[model samples]
Target: MSRERLNVQAPVHELIAARWSPRAFDARPVETEKLASCLEAARWAPSCYNDQPWRFLVADRHQEGEAWQRLFDCLSPGNQTWARRAPVLILACAATRFGHNGQPNRWAQYDTGQAMMSLVLQAIALGLAAHQMGGFDAGRVRQAFAIPDEYDLMSVAALGYPGDPAVLDEETRQRELASHQRKPLEEIAFAGRRGLGFMVPDSLGWKAKVGQSACPGTIRISIRTWLKPWSGLGSRAGGCSTWAPAPAPRRCPWPGGAFRWWPPMSLRPRWIGPGGWRSGKGWR
Candidate 1:
């Protein structure tokens, strides 16, 4: 028997299942309105005390070519080598304090994450793909971008359409181009704290069976339009996915298909089944 958990709502499964991380991107430019709409979605995301601490410093790939190059230069030599081809790059940062009250809020990081989530999903909704990188050199980024002392440097994001994964060199094409998967449900969602065994609420039980998944604030977009398809959240899988070129050319010539990078970036094989990866027409 497959025994794979069937507990996730159809929509929730779609969203969680569709999301992926990538290193290769087309050099094609993203339109301004699409970018703005994605940011607007993030702007409306719910926040603690409505602080909305997230701020973005975006370098338009073509217009700010020099600035973009500088940002790329700051990346670890390995990332700089390939990220040069990404169409858009953004620096995600968070304010140090809450807006309503001057009290230092420690939730800025979490709130920023929410905003980025909104950004990524919005990109997905806009027929675009976004890659988030944590393997950056903070000091170099801070120095190269003149990032201030106050805001915490969160992530470097690359945005563009899916591209030919074969563009990666032989060694890298084999290793860094492989797919990634998430942790199992049992290790993430808990009925109680760590070391204390617990079960999930029937209401929240899907997470326990499928590992940590989407938050209530997450939204789902149908293939027909970028608009929100669900009004309320009770645990619905978001039916979302992005398309990439076929992977046959991307497979490693080596065993396990593993290749290496300095602080090797993780690559997730994109989901390409029903309501998953698709082309200009019909659902796959």
Candidate 2:
């Protein structure tokens, strides 16, 4: 476990574990092609009615053209302190209404967020680190960018190659070094009811139970049969796989001291990892 990777509870695609926002960015200029590929990834993100409501105003520090300074100026002082070092800045915005119908699209922001997630993940795959900031002045952004009243401000992102943590201020450095936190699966995922815990096998202490049980051969056979179909999932390029092999099968203690199988993987999962991240290195 390198310091850069997140300490995830369960197995995850190496890319997701690798993604993180860093305040200390190397001042090197990002290539235009890399930026274009990132937006291209965002362009394909799924949206309600395929509205593709997300839009971006990009500022390359090397270029410094087209509202680049205006975008930087809108950032709050606290953010500006660190974002100044970033080689690229992006203004994320949302079209508030449907392009086809002119009626209000209630999911505009939500859809735009999906696009941003795609964009950010793409950035990570390219060996770039992106940190989105809510500290910018939205009103200032609207005026400075000459954005229409129909558009809504989403966020500002600072992007560049990762740099030394030592470059950050003491407090910021500490925050960057701290392990990323996520709520336990039970707290977020529910079964039949909203509050009911959906126990993931990793959190269920099932593996330890399986190890203690006398029937090791049965457990191996059952798990192997369950995961056989997905043994090589996400390993090939340009394939149609839904998930990247998560929440594998586990043995669980059933009622009256009997053991049972609960492979929530049957429900499947999200994410087709970007092809580049599947093979790219340099995230360290």
The most accurate candidate by TM-score is 2
TM-score of 1: 0.66
For candidate 2, write residues 167-257 as lDDT tens digits: 8898887676554566767788899999998863311111112222121111110111111223455222221111111111232222112
Q: What tens-digit string does per-residue lDDT give for candidate 1 at 160-184?
A: 7756655876655544444443454
Model 2 TM-score relative to the real fold: 0.70
What would you estimate as the lDDT of candidate 2? 0.63
Minimal lDDT window, size 10, model 2: 216-225
After superposition, the stretches of candidate 2 with alpha carbons farther than 4 Å from their true spots are 1-7, 202-284
Clashes of each: 14, 0
Whose lDDT is greatest here? 2
